[model samples]
Target: MLSSHCLNDDPWNKFPFTGFVAMISAVLTLMVDSITTSVFSRSGKEEPHADVASAYTPDQEMGRSHHGDHGLNLSDDKELGSTLQLLRYRVIAIVLELGIVVHSIVIGVSVGATNNTCTIKGLIAALCFHQMFEGMGLGGCILQAKYEWVKKAVMAFFFAVTTPFGVVLGMALSKTYKENSPDSLITVGLLNASSGGLLIYMSLVDLLAADFMGQKMQQSIKLQLKSYAAVLLGSGGMAVLAKWT
Candidate 1:
């Protein structure tokens, strides 16, 4: 006998376990983050600069013959290097999208569960900012991937639609959903844990590590310091937001 009055009367009651679920999500995320870092570091090797250089084609001008054929030789390292960059970019983009979609769906579910105006308003603001930054990151990856227009459209659609889909699902289930119930706790906890782990893995390993260890950052002491500071600031801001939403 689910009734609309049930939510209005027991709003706070569903919250305790929901809060626990969120925290569980956060903790599981941290553990997955740690393990991914460890595994990647262990398996990584100190690649030689010459090997790195060989991955790329020789400069087009340098390789150009007097006959003016500027096409990179199939055997040229530069062509291979460019191909590798393209591969890396596409893989990272897909992984990043997966993480973002997870976070978005969870937030959408939270919104669907609530009749509280205050919560929704705060979430809207945070989510707008979140989507903007995430879009920038994913857009860069997509551009680098150089997907054809159709494939690009499809990926974009998938990223853009996930939140709204979650909202629809949540709305449909709102009557039966109880965020604080023991069953709800276990369900949300495990879901959040999995999503959080995926996010942390993508953020630290797929994104941050790649940038930090890249040659450009390694060579620039000043940029390196600034980037780290920016990371701290971003992480701190997200942490503060967690307090409210």
Candidate 2:
């Protein structure tokens, strides 16, 4: 008969312990990404303008004034900045999806390796709910990125297939694979830790913080409170799932 011990050492058992270390790694990554993106974005703006201004001749300056070209240049700059910002958001969304996909595959493999009927049932349920919520969160970021349909399709396809692929892999190796082995524990644990950190960082810095600090949320206290409640609800649901699967 399959037992809890056979299912793999409950990594959840290490919660708040190993989780703390993961949080630190995640926070560091978030800060680094933020700082680097900010520095590059600022440099992109200033360097181009400086180069253009330095090369301007008296004739060019006169032509610019005659054509009301200063305003056009400012408009073009705004458009360029907006495009760059959108590209940044798209990249962040892709990275966030990668982290989610890694964790999903791990979870799927664990579930697939199980032979216990009852254990499988509960795991299937929990995984369904888990993926549903995760997809919603990831979908929001992708939507905001405003990707072309083909790219969106590619991202969505990978996210949808990862868990199933993992399940198939696990099933094929079920006889030989030992989920509770020390090697398995260390490998899964480290992957889980890193992926957990990445999700936390993305959720906080890229998703929640961006929306909360935006003009729309900042201007409306009622809306902000509602949004906070929604976040809490989603987080609480995931926390509860942590106890089971």
Top candidate, metric lDDT: 2
How well does model 2 score by local distance difference test? 0.75
- CA lDDT of each candidate? 0.67, 0.75
lDDT of 1 by residue, 119-177 (tens): 78888778787778888888887887677777789889988998888778778778898
List the candidates' TM-scores in order.
0.69, 0.77
Q: Which candidate achieves the best TM-score against the true structure?
A: 2
Report lDDT (Cα) of residue 130, candidate 2.
Answer: 84
For 1-245, candidate 2 gives per-residue lDDT tens digits of 01234434455353444566577769866776677567656665656343234234579667655775557978667645764576567668877888889999988887888788887888898999989988998888788777766778999998999999889877987898787776675667777777888888888888889899999999999999999999899888878877775
Residue 94 accuracy (lDDT) in model 1:
70
Model 2: residues with Cα > 4 Å off, grouped in runs: 1-17, 31-70
Clashes of each: 5, 0
